[model samples]
Target: MAGGTVLVVGGGLAGITAALGLADAGRSVTLVEARPRLGGLTHSFRRSSRAGDLWVDNGQHVFLRCCTSYRRLLDRLGVSDLVSLQPRMDIPVRSGASPRVARLRRSALPAPLHLAGALAAYRWLPPAARVSAARAALALGSVDPDDPAVDEESFGRWLARRGQGPRAVEALWDLVGVATLNAPAERASLALAATVFQLGLLESNDAGDIGWVRVPLQRLHGDAAARALAAAGVRVELRTRVGRLPTTYDDVVVATGPAVSEDLLPGDALDLAPGWSARLGSSPIVNVHVVLDSAVLDEPFVAAVDSPLQWVFDRTAGSGLDPATGQYLALSLSAAEELLGRSVAELREWTLPELGRLLPRSRSARVLDFFVTREPQATFRAAPGSRKWRPATATRLPGLHLAGAWTDTGWPATMEGAVRSGEAAVASVLGRRTERTALGATA
Candidate 1:
């Protein structure tokens, strides 16, 4: 994996990061993708409109300020402004709620106090629920990172122990779950939840600041990544799905989907007990794309706490959709297990009513068109006792390094985690000169 040439299989951020890092280090790198695009889930496409042209993303994706590696990736792409960063954490939880907002602002005070205003002002939770949520946060803040039991219990169990009922869990922890594991907190491991929340929310001020691309996902991720990698002398091939890895190619890297990697591994990967071992199950993310005649959601994004929609992102400006003409809304329904195998028509019938209820403007608005996209293996099931299932960056095979959101990057299965995992693969593949060469923009 060190000297001659390295083949990176996958065109996602993982592969792009690895290819850029490796090629910049003077290694011959070839990146291959089964799809015509490289951004994977974050890719975008165009839609025709009466006013003009419209661009929309495949899914609604967001990152926190804590995602430094991802931030660096954007900076290196020279499109840092292409994504909008919230100065603080401003989550409009529910429109029906009295205050209808929650802002997790970073303060001049210490880290704990920085969160006090947010917790104290969280109007979504009842007064008792708010106090209980504070205690829960304290409990999570104090958990030892190295504790074995931390990885064994579900976050729901921990919250239940701390007196969080279903109502509170929905208002509080489920949102955390959607942002972290992309699964319900009740079904996710306490360790992963604590890791995500403590690091992203409680431990650091400015940690929960939100960032979403202000362009089509493909433009922001795949197209831009391809240009950057090509500039670094990496050959990127799309629409070349790799079914298996060549065993003889010792310096190869597998940045493909986890299922693809599991299908290609030559060694006793299961016997070695990778972190992905425990998280064998998959979760579904169903993003219902709604094309509105006019802008329905004025906010850039909103988290639907009381509705069937987990989160909604207004990609009108960024998706290339003319705000004056049409709007594109990406509805992300996480842990959509039951809805995975359904048809787009079925989803529309089921979803539109709920969305319209949450956003009164949509009541009389005729949906120009609607579609549904599903990711069956969107994320590895981060249930209790599931941490060990994540694979390592350095695999059993020398050339076959691994990169995915599911990798043991200590971060949740997020864009940040994906970037962190890619960075790890990059650092590993560059070898000696990595410190001097590949680490240029990344470090």
Candidate 2:
């Protein structure tokens, strides 16, 4: 087990974490990735505009204070200062159906009770529905996310059974579920929804405090990782595609997407049935970037209800846009099944008018630039019965493991899940090596 050679495929957060951990443990690790960059899904690109070269992220990704593993990865990469976390959780919610803007800010109280005041005063929901929502939240806190029965039911049906009507689901449940789960309550599993609520809201008061990157994702993740990997003595091979699993390495960690992992692993490596990756499915996310001549959104970000706009974030600082000249905003559209097929021109037409209704200042602002970025396979679809498709880190074949957000980490497909999968894979690899060494010594 000492100084064993390990190969990590896919240079995303999972692969990067595995490589760094293995190298630090005195293992010779080689990280390979097909893409030219390292931060797989979370990346950025430069776009030419009249204002100047604008840095645009593929998608707007945010993490919570509860995501310790992901934050540790950021610290390890030496880019912890490049991101900012909220002093406390506060979200400015705007509904196109109503002119009033609601706030979902938490107070300095304990779990469950911290959100009581916010829920009681939520302008989107009726007084009766808010009370019902609070009761449902408490009921959900008790649901075991690891239970097989919980995975069999939809969150929406569970809410309805607990007296949560359409208004509660739309105004309260969907507000959080759609952004985090990447699926509506009706399509999302009760198990996954319970996990998000319990860990983020019910379990602790500060767990749901949001954090986002202030710099381009590329600089924060990929660039920093490259420097860290080099210092760790891990060999990094970018733009290298491994058609078959290499036999030379003592251990191999397949950290690619489900489809890619399935193709690379041995037929009998995993215990799951055939076509499990396909059954796992995927969800899409579309990001619309808009540059205006004048500042429209005053806050850092805002969530929308009863409108096509899901979440709008001020990207001026991150994109290096001159604030004096204009403003840059990014609209993050999750579970974007309907908008995926729409043309760029069609999106601009529909989005501009909607912005006028949601943010009145946008109506008079001159349009400088408008573009869209789409990820068809953004994340694994977290629908009912999805846990069966996500396998454990250890494989049937010895010395082989899987690392990705799609794996069974008891969490949804998120950055935290991805980092946890990598850590688990490393643990499995080292644990097996120790077992083999013990057997040899006894012999």
Off by over 4 Å in 1: 1-3, 49-53, 95-106, 247-250, 269-279, 431-443
Give the whole-model CA lDDT for all candidates, comma-separated: 0.75, 0.91
Error of 1 at 434 (Å): 13
Residues 1-443 of candidate 1 have per-residue lDDT tens digits of: 34567788888877777777777667888888899888876787777655456676767788888889989888877779788898877777764433255654556566767777777787777888888888888888987655668888888888899999998888778876765687787788888888888878887778888888877788888888878988887887777866656543326777776666776665454345443433466777888888888877878888866777778888777766666766778888888898888888788888888887777778687787687777788877877776666777875434457888878787777888888888899776655222212211100
C-alpha lDDT of residue 165 in model 2: 88
For model 2, give the 10-residue run with minimal summed lDDT. 434-443
Q: What are the models' TM-scores?
A: 0.90, 0.97
